[model samples]
Target chain A: MSHAIETIDLKKNYGSHAAIRGLSITVEPGTVFGLIGPNGAGKTTTLRMLLDVIRPSSGVARVLGETPQAGGPALRRRIGFVPGELRLEGRIRGRALLRHYAEISGQVAPGAVDDLADRLGVDLNREVRKLSKGNKQKLGLIQAFMHRPELLVLDEPTSGLDPLVQREFLTMVREARANGQTILLSSHVLSEIQQTADQVAVLSDGLIVAEGDVAALRLGRIRRVRASFTGIAAAALRQELDHLPTLRDIDIDVTGTEPVRLTATIDGDIDPLVKLLARHSVLDLAVEEPDLEESVLQLYGSSANGRNGEVRHG
Target chain B: MVRVLPVFRRSLGDSWRSLIGWSVGVAAALLLYLPLFPSIGGDGEMQQIIESMPPELVKTLGYEQIASGPGYTQGTFFGLIGFLLLVIAATAWGSAAIAGAEESGQLELTLAHGVSRSQYALESALAVLVKLLWLGLLAAALILALNEPSELDVTVLNVLGASKALVGLAFVSASLALLVGAATGRRSLATAAGAGIAVLGYVFNAIANQVADADWLRALSPYSWAYHEMPLSDGPDWAGLALLWGLGAVFAAAATLLLRRRDIIG
Candidate 1:
């Protein structure tokens, strides 16, 4: 199959409110595709429809080159999934739970589960219900990753994980992609997707606002940069930096007429801004990574929604 | 080659404790009420006491014939206490299998694997049937054990017949519960629907016994279909048993279909 996943005019409605409005995207096989959006942006809805956990109101989704309903259980055998809102409750120990899951999802080599558990450092001997949230998340990861399915669809996979474990998870993702597996993962955190995804689709308000290569989207991402200078007046600093493209909302403050402090959001590369500041005696600089919603708004706020490297599917 | 019905296996694993508890409960109810037949059974003063009550009340209670051996067994265990115990156990198992798992997110996770919707529901149906059968067989064995000791003269064939009828009746209730639970994904709603079927059936049968105009209700009530012939004393009602079994099958089928249509809510 040329595309591991493809959706055309995908739509879902919760009563009168349309949760997903005509979503369309295509992911090449053997690549990491990140679906990034804030909560309620319909990212979960789109991913769930692909997994056939939720049916679409209209349009079609083809995964692994088969319509989900036509593929049925046979198609799902080639997939591994982790729900966004995970709830696992049982009196049985985690090891038994994992074993049971493996038995249901086709075959797994002996010790496959144990190996994953060891890597995740999750104690599978404890009862599933009694384990902490992070531990339960680890167990979820092990189950999804153990089978080594052709397509892995994970939603908010690192919500409850510590940074160390999250790093380990990204490593696993990298390794999975290297093995020619297609990964479709959803996240509200920009950096998570930036670190693992080869291609990214930014979703907002039930629409794809931007889609492109990770580096392309990175350049399009808006960051609020604050800098202080001692040699230039606030007006002169604003005029000089303003000439450099990709800057907006320039706010400057001069308290005691000593150092000029300027705060503004830059849409594209910060390299030009840095070179311009090198000529002045720079004091302090703080650049902030906007949260997902802010970043999405900033993307939509610019021409990047179309001509700015946004990939259009065929 | 396949997973050996792995979904069914795991469901049973999760259900063993509750199934055992229910079996013990049905057995205890039978053991408690049957042995007393010796002291308070037969057509002597006990019949007078039953007669002294309001005619509607005696008929409603199914105490019209408590003197004969088979009559005493039917009146004490099969038609009354044991049926209640068995139906309660069935409904709980039925509702918990699908609706309970749905609420806890276990259903979504298991279902997202290679298990098809129909396959999962069918396996759940199998689990429900197997668990209910455990209680049914245990109830039959307990009553048979007390048959001679309690002066119950029920024939072995008739005892087994009545056990089958009781199980069939409970199966209808449990399947109804499973159907509603699968459709709604609400545990409380499904449990109520399951228990409602049995409760309404029992109450309708009682009302039909008193009100002559309500005779047609007996045909609609699974409870009446099960005990109308008093299978313990008069032999089994094969037609009625068939209807009960048939209705349970329809409900189970409908449940599987409904599960196939809805989304798996986490």
Candidate 2:
């Protein structure tokens, strides 16, 4: 299968500081690939390189099988991009700006911009400066998606958007995917990516710390498991669960001997924990994936240590 | 190849209010000044007053031969006030075309939609050129309308010649700003570069007119090429016109090349 976007050892440096260091990744056609990273993690830099807005210091990037720099405007025509920092012409009405961009691309179907605007709950007649930040973001998204390009590169697409609008925006992304459009979405929000991305790459300090299918990553990482038990003493439960290889930070609470509740986090594998739980009279159990914020913090903490070790060895 | 018409149209839309304001201002300046030429030209007392003034002051103000119709018009309007107004307009537009847009983050958004860097630079230059043309034509038309009434002996051909020179001079200034903005992506720097050129050219030409030994400086000043032959009375200076236009074109081309090779910073 042909890749929609590919970067091989892509690097961008500003003097001595490297924004992106030896980055390589690929997205298959019609798949929504998420680039999950915190601020200053080089997500914007990578997107800019792919758009050819800035040249890479070294290495190569190809979109739709063409080197983006060599492709010039022709290559850009086939891709739609929403910048993280969106600034529109304040004097022009939102619809007018959208029309101008549509005319430049020369590919949007008549009324496509209006349709997208309506779906996103944006008033196109308002001057951009008069619109709220969320409204302005909607206008930006409309322009990027109006032409229905084969690929979409969105940087922090949901920033400044309210929860409802963010959900609507994700719907648009999913709809775009259904139409066979490949998407590369970069964001610091992990849940946003988890909800939509087929595959995700976690970036830290300009390098990919982890990458895989979202479901697999969820299973492979830590999970918060809570259990409530009857006919079991809290002390016995704590003793039974002690030294279990898969669990950590174990906490047990007993309420006047009515019921015992156990809470702990499990890492790597859950099978061992499940066997331990089977030995107890479990009345209820809940297993939840770690929230995006916590997941990112953990990833960063672990990666920092790993990087420090590498630095020492080098 | 990336259709620049959209950019051109958008530029006009964004700036039409300023264009209209400038047009009105140029008309007002012309109508206010041209009608005074008849009274000013025929007044013997005023002529005596001007003649008694210091020669250096007369030369500095470009009123060395203001007793005649063509000389009065050149001294009061074309050589002084009109040139300043047009150059100011050109400089503002040129700086805004790339540098202002880049600073505001509009350039990045526009380029992400398939417009090449070269196309963006060229279209922006073209937009400034067109707006400058509109202001130039407004000045010419107003002058033509008041020509017979003001008893100014300048012909329609001469009026057009002067307007053409004004446009050429403004184009050179605008293109220099455009080039600097495109290269540096800084509006203040572009403004400084354009204003510096205009001021330097004017100072050089003014000093050259007063000091015979400094005549060589005129060759290096765009201001001299514009007003040396007194285009309103004499026909357009073809060589000077060619030089002004050639400089504009060269600067515009250089800007495009520089824009294509450099990274666009926000």
Candidate 3:
């Protein structure tokens, strides 16, 4: 598949610090590519470089196969971008701002801008400075998606929006994807892309540590079953299960007089264990499946994990 | 070019009513100067007083070449009007170019779009040109209506020459503002710097003209060669006019180059 956006060893420096160091990424056309990372993960820096808002210290980037710095207007004409922060002239009405952006971005289909504004529920007649954060985001959305661009680069697009609005925004994204628009979205919120992205690139400290199809990355890392049984000798059961090999490496709890809970990293094919449990009285069986939240934590290890096991992906 | 017109219209719209109000007010003020015209003639007491003053002071208010008739009056008219209006126009031009963009976030947004740095510079120059032309036509019409026909005829050619010179100087100030605006990325500083350059140019011109012995000082000001013979009083000096035009063009070119190379959001 053709790549809509590609970066080759793109690096950005601020005096002594390297914000994005030797970073490279490629987003395929017609794919909802998610760029996931914590704050200060160089996501914004990467987006800025792609848009040519800031020049790279070294390396090259191509948007739609054109150097972003040189006449990329043709490419830009077909791309939509929403920055993390939206700052505009507060005095001008939202309608005027849209008109200015529409004019600057070159030609668009007739009445398309207004239609998008209406869908986004933005009051274009209100002065921009007076609009709330969510309204501003809506306005930004209108500008970005109004032209029905082939590529959309949205940075923390859902930042200040309510859950309902965020859902609507996701629907917008889904619709864009359905229409074959390539979306390269960066967000600290994992759930934002959890249902939207086809592929995800996890960025950490300016590096992409893991990236692949979201389902593939998340597969095979789920929780194992932990079952307890009553009316059984804990030691005897442990020995029998160990001998069976299917229930090997079990941690038995023997303090209770009734039943003992055993935890194990269960592999596939549990038919034998099921047959064995039928012969004895199984009590308080609990199977805990490790969620994608924990999988991400285990991938990053402790220092980067948020709140121990309490995933705060947003 | 098509892209710049809407922006130019919107920019003017932002201050259109007020600018028109001010223009009418200025015209009325110019009418106040009409009664003083007869007294400004050679035989009047005011003219005698002007004639008696030291040549340096006389030259300061531009009274040296009254023998040329209404051309003399018309020349001072263009000069004074050009100087004052250039200041106002430069402020508008600079503030609109720099602060206006910064304030509206349009500068950031436009720069973010695939607009090349040179294109932004060119569009901005076009906006300035539009404003200059509008003000030039106003000045020309007023001068023609008020000019004395019995004395020296202020022909359309003279008006055109004088108007072109005024437009050149206005553009020079505007181009300098854009350069400063792009460099500093602040509107106020750009306005101040643009206005400062115009005032400095005027002062340098006056000092150099007063000290005729100091020929080197003439080179210090861009205006030194700009106001030769005064408009309508004598045929326009093509060389001086060309120099001002060339300076404006160079300033505009330099601004575009710098804007292209710098990071705008900075």
Candidate 4:
């Protein structure tokens, strides 16, 4: 499949510190691809490099088949960008900025910007500095989408937005995806990506830890298993259960502090524990499936070491 | 380009404040000119006052032919006013074209829309052209109104010379601001440099006029070239005017090259 955006060993350095190192990812055309990471994980820095706003120290990146650094005006015309911290002219009204942006982007519909503003509930007449954070985000989104660009690069797009507006924004993103627009969205928020992204790449310490189709990445990563036991004192049983090699942690208070407690972790493909528990007097046992949050945390979350879905902490 | 219209429109919109500010300067210049008009209208003290004034003061006011009846009104009266007008016009155009955009963060957004740094510089240069045209028209109207008497030929020539002078001066100012704006990220620094260049240009003009033998000094000041064009006293100095415009182009091109290399968002 032809990719809309791709980076090969992309690296960026700020003085002595590396914001992104040996980062590589491919985004297919017409798909929503998310770059998920914790704060300061170089997500925004990578986005800036892709948009040609920042230069990379090494490696190469291509946007729509053109080298971003040398790609001049012609290549930029095919892409739209929303910066992490958008600073617009304070004197100009929101509509004026939008109109100017559309005019500069070239070949956009007459009322396209106005319609977007209306739909986003952004008051275009208000000056940008006076607008609320959500309104400013709406303005930023309108500018990026108004030109109907082939590729949209948004950095921290839903910042300061209320949950309802964020939902609406995602709906807009879905509509864009339906129309065959490529999106490179970077966000620290988990639910935002889970609802929208078809593919996810988790970043940490300036490197991609894991990347794949969201379903494939989430399939085996999240762990949700609970077990209750008998024939042992409540405290002693909990203490003894912690010594088990497969089940390293057990929260006795949450698991009812009696002859029973619970342990959850990456399954490590161990079903013999269930068999061993069957031999014991078991009052109750539950093995709940893990959700996207658990899987994401397992992959990119700070607590997860640079391991392949091996989350030790329960 | 249609893309440039917004810069032009925004520049014009922002110019309203500068226009109001220049109006205040214009009022003061007109106040200074009012007392001299009577001297031109054949007042008794006209010759005595002309005889007593030092040549340095006359040179400062571009009053080479002050003994003539119309010289007082046409030369000294309008010359000082024209110089001040061009200064204000240039400052207004230059600041709006470059420093104002840097201050407002509009340059960052403007450059993001497939608009290259060179294109931004070109659009900004075009915006300055629009300002020159509008200000040229305003000065022409005012000059025409002030010169509605019998000597229409001389009056028209003087106004035309002033118009050309203002255009050249605006170029110098706009180009200087652009160069500073491209080099520095802060708007205040660009504006301060622009204003400093303008005041220094005026000083150079004064020095060159007082010491006419100082040909090197005259060549150094953009104003000196236009000052020699004195339509009320002599005729247009087309070569000097050409040189001023050439310098303006060079500065603007330098600004564009710098802008291409540096990051506007930074």
Candidate 5:
């Protein structure tokens, strides 16, 4: 498949401070690509470069097989973008704002804006200043999707959106992907991207720490497993848990309890722990993915010394 | 060829209320000041009161021709109050065209919709020009309607000429603001550039009229180019008109070039 977006060693520097450093990546056409990063990790900067709103200090970026800056308005016409910081003119009603954008793009159908507004539950008659944050976000989303462009570049698309509206947004993204449109979704929230992105790139401190298929990346990380024993003593379970090679940071709570509970984090392999559990009369067992916040923190802490080289391919 | 019509249309829609407000203000100022000219010009006592004042103050205020209908109207309204009103309107429009939009994050959104930077800047300048023209025409119509009743003795042609000079003078300040706003994307800097041009021009003209050695300063002041010959009585100064329009065009062209090269910050 041809690439939808490609950047070769893209760099942006604000005087002496480097915002994005030697970044290179390729996104396949018709795939939902997630740019996952923490705040100030240069996600918005990268998106702005692709849109030609800001020029790169070095390297190059191509959208839809053309240089962003050289392609000019024609290139921009094929891409829909939602900026992270969305500020609308307070005097304009929401409908008028969408109409203006629609007229400029010249691609949105007559009723597309109204249809999207209905789906998103946004009232188009209200002035922008009167709309709440969530409502304003809905307006932004409607404009981005109304044009039905070849590519959509969204930066923190779900910020300030309620969970229900966020779900609707994800569904819209899925529909766009199904329609053969490529999407570049940038977000600090892991789950937001994890739900819709087929491929993910994790950026930390201006460097890509890990990148691959979402499922594969999840599998590579550690998981927390908690188990409670009914017919066994806590001491007996602890002794068995020590023998398991896969378990780490193992903790046991045996304080005057009829049921013994043990919690441990495991990585690499879980078969040894499974066999140990099978030997005990386990009453309840829970295996949970690590919290996204904690996982990001751990990733940053661990990669401080040995930054993972950019994972370019899936 | 990028289409900037959508941007232009939206700008007009956004500013129509302010445009009407400015038009009403100019009309009121004209009605209030033009009718008073007959009373002041016909009364010999008022002329003597003016003659008794300091010669320097009369020269500075451009009141030498206060005894005639044309002179009285020009001194009271066109040269003083009307000039202030038009410049205020133009300055606000010019500063808001680029820098205000950028600060509000609307420029980024508009450009994302396939509008080229140069096209956006050019269209914004055109919108400001159109608004300025609207105010000028309204002022001219009101002046012409009240000409006979107020006994100002100024013809319709002369009223239009005076309006042209006012619009041309305001254009210089507006264009300066557009240039600064487009180049720097800072509203305060744009406002300062526009207000500075107007204030400095007025000060330079006033000082030139008061001091013999500084008479050459009038050549550098846009205010002089606007009102030096009293457009209503002497007809429009074609040379001054050329200079004002030429400066506006130059600043607008510079703004487009600079906007194309600079980065847009939200």
Candidate 6:
């Protein structure tokens, strides 16, 4: 079977400014593929090109074994899309808007929209304009997923969603994958993609700067830790923590004198650092899920360098 | 199977409130002007007033014929006030269908479904037609209701024909706006284009009225094509109606072509 989406050297330019420069990636038929990038990273542009919503300046894009231009409405019917900026306007109820889309999609199963709405905890009876931003975003997701399309292209699908709803959305993605739907989900949140995406391509400056297995990237990702101590000296603490096997980028400070803080970003196994930290009289300890965009850039930026799918422009 | 003309249906559905407003406004226009023809029209006072006014002003405003029923109808409504109302409505409809929707991100989401771009453009045009047709029918109905009472001696068929011509004239504006919206994806620009066509046509006609040698200008002005034959009084101008509709179709086709070639940046 052909790849679900295959773009070879595809590029897009708006005037003289290039939005997507020679992006190439192959997505398999039944997995969650994440397009990870920042706001102007060309992620949305690449997705639009695949849908033929935007024309690429150059290169080849074959979606479901057909060029997007030639595939036309037939290809679009197989793919569900949620735009990056969801704008749901109208005095009609959210359910009615969904019904309108369902009629347009035609392939939507009966009760599919209601099911998604229930899962997302959004009321369909509310007028679309009266809906909260997050609720509108949920409606956007419902319209896209209600059809159970073969390929789903979601851009920043969870941006306005609450944490609970976002978790449910990831579950929906997983369930869709289990049902054998191929997904091309794009977002700036690394943890969002890390939780659900099987393979990810980190896009930066209109190019795929890194592409790799999500599992490998996850294992290779750095964890940030902040620990406050009762009596540990800053210099002595760094000296002791530096000997640990996996910790790197260690910072020990307090802004004053008492309760010196030890903040370190570490990669690999955490057992050695945990055991060493136990030796100190720890006061306040907090382990944060690293900043989404920062952690993502670090993982895809440094480690995935010189790997497959990395593009460079002079 | 997909619903046929969902875009058309949704667009009309979305504007049902606005449609009602336009209907009421048309009814009000009929109530305001047609019933007063007895006092202002056929009394010779109105005709004398026109004769006393500058000849250029009378001709430019088409008020010279206010002494007659059909002429009063054309002067007060079809050629001026009523035409403006309908053209404004049509222009808003056309601009919103493409450029406004695209700007708000509605068009992209809709297009992401199974609907083709060409189909979207075609259906939007149909939606505009359906809307203008609704307003036209309301005007014709109200005008016919007053045809006898207001001494607007125009026949029922003639009133209907004039209304049809009015719809066609506004349709040209709507279609041109739709074409611009598709090409540029800018609502303001589309509005300007639609209004520009209506103004250009009217200016052409107005200028031709002054210059005796500018009878040829009538051929180029869409306003002339719709009104120069005096369809309200003489009879429906089949050639003029056909030209108006033909221009509408050309613009619609151009819009579809432009949309099919470019990207929907929204």
TM-score of chain A of each: 0.91, 0.82, 0.73, 0.77, 0.86, 0.91
* Model 2 lDDT at residue A137: 90
lDDT of each: 0.85, 0.85, 0.71, 0.70, 0.85, 0.88
Clashing pairs in 3: A89-B104, A223-A289, A223-A290
How do the residues B1-266 of candidate 4 rate in per-residue lDDT, one tens digit apiece?
26656655666664566666665565555445544554453454666775688978867666666555346544643456655575556655666565567556566556666777776776777677666656666655654665544222345676666667666776787778777787765666666766676677767877877775865777777777666656444656688778878888888898888877764443
**What order do you get sorting by TM-score, best first?**
6, 1, 5, 2, 4, 3
For model 1, how does the per-residue alpha-carbon lDDT over A1-314 read when each residue is reduced to its tens digit? 56999999898998899888878889998999999988988988887888788899999899999988888888888898888888888888998898888877756877888888888899989998899899999999988888899999999999899999999999999999999999999999989998999998888777787788888765345888988889788777877877977899988895748888889989877898888888999889888988988877655745323342343331
Q: Which candidate is the best by DockQ?
A: 6
**Candidate 3: regions farther than 4 A off:** A15-17, A36-40, A90-93, A127-130, A159-162, A202-206, A209-314, B1-22, B25-29, B40-43, B48-58, B63-77, B98-104, B148-153
- The sequence of per-residue lDDT tens digits that candidate 6 reaches over residues A109-206 is 77787788889999999999999999999999988888899999999999888899999999999999999999999988878888899898878778
> Which lDDT tens digits does candidate 4 get at residues A1-314?
56898899899887799887788889999999988777877888898777666678899998888888688667777788887777664566888777767766756777888788777788888887898877888898999988889999988899978887788889989999999999999988766877899988877768777777766664343456777677756676555556556564456544545556656664455575666667678888777655544555554576334443432221
* Clashing residue pairs, backbone N/CA/C < 3 A, model 4: none
Q: Estimate the overall C-alpha local distance difference test score of candidate 1.
A: 0.85
List where candidate 5 sits over 4 angstroms from the true fold: A219-294, A300-314, B1-4
Where does candidate 2 chain A have its weakest 10-residue lDDT segment?
A: A305-314
Per residue, candidate 5 scores C-alpha lDDT tens digits across A145-195 of 898999999999999998998998999999999999999999987878889
Point out where model 1 deviates above 4 Å: A218-220, A226-244, A253-262, A272-285, A301-314
Cα error of candidate 6 at position B47, Å: 1.0
- Residue-level lDDT for A265 in candidate 2: 86
Query: What's model 4's lDDT at B150?
Result: 25
Using TM-score as the measure, the top candidate is: 6
DockQ of 5: 0.49
Candidate 1 TM-score versus the reference: 0.93
Better of 3 and 4 by DockQ: 4
A289, model 6: CA deviation in Å? 3.3
DockQ of 6: 0.76
Candidate 6 fnat reads 0.90
TM-score of 2: 0.88
Q: What TM-scores do the predictions have? A: 0.93, 0.88, 0.76, 0.77, 0.91, 0.95
